[model samples]
Target: MEHPALIIVDVQNDFCPGGALAVPEGDQIIPIVRAWAEDFFRQGYPIVTTQDNHPPHHISFGERGGPWPPHCVQGTLGFALHPALQLPPHAVCLKGEDPDQDAYSGFEGLVEGPEGHREPLASFLHRASVDTVYVAGLATDYCVKATVLDALKAGFRTIVLRDAVRGVDVNAGDSARALEEMAGQGAEIR
Candidate 1:
């Protein structure tokens, strides 16, 4: 069996319904993600959660002149994880906390900081002996896409659970195009 790691990316309140940057029907993925998490937990596979922990004045928010609205602010109710997806001990990986940076990929922060880089994923998977990674979470057009791309670049076999993700479809075909791009990059979308 391929040694697999389940990478849950950015299932935060800010990406769900009634959120600042809410994707259409984003909460729809919660049940699916929860089910997958349960399966991974039962199978004893390694699981890692990626959180978009942005500061209050994050550059990715409109308050900071970003196109998007305020969201995922650090230490706010908007930053909380989805209620349905259970987080076990040590499964969390936080990023995008720097108000100046915007990190979409779980493997690495978007912009570099002076406090030395934080790459918890590469070492975590290597130490856990994970050869393949199953990725699922919100905003397929953004963070989910970045995470899968980085996973492939890291030389890990990658799979994106299509049913367990939602996209920030700004336009009509944004989500579809995003999926196509990811598939073209050798990501198995299921």
Candidate 2:
């Protein structure tokens, strides 16, 4: 039987409030995520998580010629999950490993083509018989948006927990616009 999985995206320390690349009130999602994860587990639905495991000098960081601050360096404390979320020890899928690839979407890595291909998250979700995916975590306008869109494109029913997301909102309009766009793409918001 097909089971719905909770695809919790980047809930790393660096994206939490008070971290290197803090999203406003990012820590606020911890309790909600924990509760949802627990509820899903108790309901017997499998949980799969994605972590932004970037290299120390990853190109997404401003220090590495990107627009954002240096954050989520591979294996660093900042790269670990937010402490309060209490992530299950074994549910994580580490992505963004290649420094040259800037993975805004957990669906696929930044690098593609013959030499540096990474696993397609959509295919994994499909293989797992996932009919619906509940996404929650980190910046709404970037990774979360990308993942939701890709999930839809992959034909999975997608839902975004509005209260559990925090957006970087670099231009002040990102949160609202991202939500509108995702909804326009057929994702249910709850």
The prediction achieving the highest TM-score against the true structure is 1
User: lDDT tens digits, residues 31-77, model 2?
Assistant: 99999999888887867778888878888878777998888887798
Residue pairs that clash (backbone atoms under 3 angstroms), model 1: none
Collision pairs in model 2: none
Q: What is the Cα-based lDDT of residue 125 in candidate 1?
A: 87
Q: Please report the candidate that would top lDDT against the real structure.
A: 1
Off by over 4 Å in 2: 109-119
Q: Model 2 — which ten-residue stretch has the worst lDDT?
A: 109-118
Q: List the candidates' TM-scores in order.
A: 0.91, 0.90
RMSD of every candidate to native, in Å, equals 3.5, 4.0
Model 1 lDDT on a 0 to 1 scale: 0.83
Candidate 1 structure quality by residue, lDDT tens digits, 1-190 = 8999898888888888888788888888888888888888888998888888887778988877887888888888778897766655436678887788788899874322237555567887887899999998878999899999888899999999989888988888887898899889998998
